[model samples]
Target: MRRLAAGVLSLAVAGILLAGCSPAPASDDSPLSAASPAPSRSTVSAGDPDLPAMPPTPAPSAVVDDAAADDAGERLRALVGDAGRPAEVALLGDSFAAGEGAGSYQPVRGVADSLCHRSADALLADAAGTPPSPPGTAILHNLACSRARMSSVTAAQAVEGHGPEGVPAQLEQLAGIRPDLVLLSIGGNDLGFAGLLQACVVDTEPCGQDPALRETTRQQLLQLQAPLTDVYRTLGAATPAPVLVLPYPRLFDAGAEDCGRLSSTELAFGLEITDALNSTIERSVQAANLPNVRYVNALEDSFAGRGACSPDPLVNTARFGPLLNAATSVPASQEVLHPTQEGYRVLTRDLLRWLEENPM
Candidate 1:
């Protein structure tokens, strides 16, 4: 994390965080992250070795041409809803940000490995709502892959091994594609939230009360400030298009006593950690203070009764029956802990609402 935050030249990247102040249930409880580390058998391993810490980032505009700003604004206005001009939206982030755990997935390219479970049914897949798509109105170019980190956006990556040269850097892709909007979700994997969840899933004993684990994760999250600020700046520098960032809605209801095998302490850990994550992201965006970034930033509250263990779980939960069963055909279990189709639909609705409220 120190290495990730050291380098500076941009504002923020495949971003995560929100607006809200849900209190932690206990002093010992710590914040967690939004990414899921597990990869499908056909995909690449979802891990990136930590880079040595780099120097702090400079101003995002330092590398960008000042002349592009007005051009960008004009481009956005001219293209949006134009009968002949198509508006493109670029998406970046991890499993939570991608179409993971929801809808059908796009076909993986070639025989090469990729963790990108990019979904054809993704929330942004249809920018103008139900298809037949507005002719030259809006299009979605989902660059998000599962387990992508802050660096993936700031630096060029090697995961999407489709063609001989492979995919370009996501940030660069934004410049080349020059979409009207960019949506991001990241930071969970960087904080190693996967390990914390693994601790909870593998052990019945509460993992939330572990002071060392909580503190360590908390510190790592704080380190994200600089890099988060840089990436958003870099993103802002890359184009005049607006950036819309979304937070992962709560997985388990914080107020709920338990979620399946998860105890109250475990539940509290998830809830508080998520709140911290969103708050951190919101603060970073504010620090960058770029005019183009729009985060309806709040600790997600709309999906209150629709948590993982709720009567109506918008997010997918563990399927112990499938895990323990010998002959049950419950399909695959890759979507656990992520959002369901319904969740994606609702989030899409919220995103559109925010867009409506914050027009270009």
Candidate 2:
């Protein structure tokens, strides 16, 4: 393991803190099936995988671009939904919102240490827990699965590997809850991006040098745009509140030496595909223009421009330091391919800020 720099970044990244608040009962007390049983999953992971520390983020500042700032503010206003009184807020998608590692709750809080990664019930509980309002003021339903796909977002899509129901079934279940606001994050599984990224790590051939494989991946990524467009339309039309679609986070670490492991070709191809997918999503959201539909700039805030090759990759694979836990008390693995818990915390904080800045 390499020696990681010990600074505010390292401390924030490695040190895990439990909130001073006590754990709430794992059940929703809201009107929308506040007592619904948790979803059943045959196989489950123990707890969230510990993430590495990150450099401290600069304080939130104004977005310089006039148009970008306007757009962001507009989106935030829309998200708050009638002064934060949205009728129903349903969370939809894959593992990002499912709280997979955190185990099921009667009312569903988020996965431990998961920031944006939350179940609908958890988000609603958080919203409700905000004082003045009890949880469940708005219906919150989570329809995300661990390894869901773009097709999964479609009405009748099926799960190929495991699980009793498909994403559409879950969505239908959410529809039953009749939410007013829907937060969605999906498509990674469909593109098989994660698997391909792992392959890129070990491939002996220079990355992106594999034109044939590159083209195949590119087309698949492009294909994902269509499903995203369709799902947005479908979900937007179903519920009264506008739908908020979130983009995937970049899975590469930035400024780390191991990043050299990824050839320029691989990095280029990864960026190209991810960007294209995001572009399509933005356009589709605009074209649809549903009354309550909106786009949450997940990629733009945390991942835009900064990819695996940027100064900071939230999901990095590069070696900054020990790459593993320094403390013998608990062994930690620095897997740069996923958001470190710290990275996710940053995302969560930003996400909340984004919501504040662009409340619907």
Candidate 3:
């Protein structure tokens, strides 16, 4: 196992402190059934001999133009629906979907609020209550938890472990409900991103120069394809709804200089990892070949000028004291890598646009 840096450790401690101050549980009015019992699976090996060769990862670029954004908005406005007949939507995955960096997290009924960290500010939250146009509501069933891997979608497991002993599988939360759409943002934890970031951001050594870490990350990336393919296939078979798989956005601009705690070299290394993770997801979706399952490429275009190093960043990049002391304060270092409330808003915009253009 990799060693965590002092800064990262401190961030973890800070998160725990923040969790203690969270408010009481909210109403459990979501359109989901009782949780299903966890399922068993064979131990996943590092490399599966049956897997095929993956394509080369694409270079990071901003592909969405102003005309595209405007066209998407127009399409959304044109959606026809009966008044008060809301669309049933389900959300699943890890920190990104749960809104870790975005503040105002909503507490689960039976579980500790801090464990799942499903923020009211999450993109799905915005989409749930508010439809693309007026009089068209979106009722949501969110089962996203922080630190969730692909396995967490279908098996009971210990997640980020900040506030609860264990969490029920996300799929279990969707037992009897048939949603119109399911948005999933997952697979980063399987890559062991927390540990990788610790080494890159908090440690003294440049991540690019660390052969052992790089090799390990590469191996993990290779191992992820089979399991990810399996997950997509399972979700496709289980749900009649269209399952949209959202990939992680680029956190830094490779061509730009570092801004905040991350150095230029460190930013470049992080970008490489992000690309590899996204590539793996895309390849796995293709391998699944489910017509109902489609990959969302909104992040690349939506996050164009909003990396950690950008002049107007969607993701957080502030250092400790300044971040913690701000009027709209962010608590920890882990939070720094995640999308802010503004970032989530931008994500929601892109998602709605994509959904409008590619109607199911």
Candidate 4:
């Protein structure tokens, strides 16, 4: 029965990859090449009961489990002194924070809302490079979901939750739990990532070359400044915890000779988009000026030279193939343009480095 379930799970997970990961297109036919700006995206606001009940998932990944268990032993061995309390950490935001792109959801027992595409290899669970503290050092509440946006994550709603199963906003969930730390990565959806994907991958025209489109995107992103500042303020006021805002990595290096299926123009455009995103985030964080809220340039260096166009890309391309589990099943469609497990590992390594250098 277990094996059978696993097989079924593999097929279902593959459904995301095999079918394709295109989001509903924007109103303007040419997303990036359009004469007019694309409209803002709709997020999970006010009980977004659109999706059907989630598919069953395989058991959690063993890599994290083993690492956790070993860390526990190490902790036991080092119990003579300085046994600090575990930090209760909360993760909030979209697919990046949810680990949705790392492949294959892991069903955490009693965590129904975790069907929000939680993965075992999300950065916090295990350190990729050097040991920063130990594994299992923090009590994690991963409240991130695929397709999440600013509206879905903040405490703006009057109601309890904005999504299925009454899963409250990430901030609301964190409020109830009173975590000691928070990690957030959002804003891409607000800028219409899906539409951008359609433009770059689905369309034949050189959408990237359109100066008007780029300006439109920039204008849209700029509009988020005030609201983002407010969101940062809300977060700071909500908890005494340190809020580390992580910006998304550039999906392509844009300088490499080979760009897979992506044209050079598209890759260059991707770089521009990422730069704009990081800059927006940094500015917002700075404007917030809260001692607790800090921005981490998490992937700018680590992801360099390892873009979708590179020979050893960390980010996934549309329908290319799975990085780790090619034989078992294809990658999830949500994994498209998302970081692979290895990519997550690199992120983990960078995060650990940051933590070590700047201990709170």
Candidate closest to the true structure, highest lDDT: 3
lDDT per residue for candidate 1 within 1-360, as digits (tens), equals 533332110111111111001112233434333233211112211111231221211111111133432233234435354545666777887676667777576644453334466776676443432223555446677777665677778665545355654455678656667666788887766665555555554554677766665665566667776788887788777778777767666677546776544677777676666656665666678778899875664326545666777766777654333223211211223355677776665666555545556676
Quote the positional error of residue 121 for candidate 3 in Å: 1.9
Tens-digit per-residue lDDT, 45-130, candidate 3: 12332444333334323333445444432333344222446666777888788787787866665545455667777774555652
Instruction: Estimate candidate 4's alpha-carbon lDDT, on a 0 to 1 scale.
Output: 0.57
* Global lDDT of model 3: 0.62
lDDT of the candidates, in the order given = 0.55, 0.45, 0.62, 0.57
Candidate 3 clashing pairs? none
TM-score of 1: 0.70
Per-model TM values vs. the true structure: 0.70, 0.57, 0.74, 0.70
lDDT of 2 by residue, 198-304 (tens): 44544567544555555455455444555667777887777776577876554442222245445655554444445444555665677677867787764333643
The 10-residue segment with the lowest total lDDT in model 2: 30-39
**Candidate 2 vs. true structure, TM-score:** 0.57
Q: Considering lDDT, where higher is better, how would the candidates rank from best to worst?
A: 3, 4, 1, 2
Report the Cα RMSD per candidate: 14.0, 15.0, 10.6, 11.7
lDDT of model 1 at position 136: 46
| Consecutive 10-residue window with the lowest summed lDDT within model 4 | 39-48
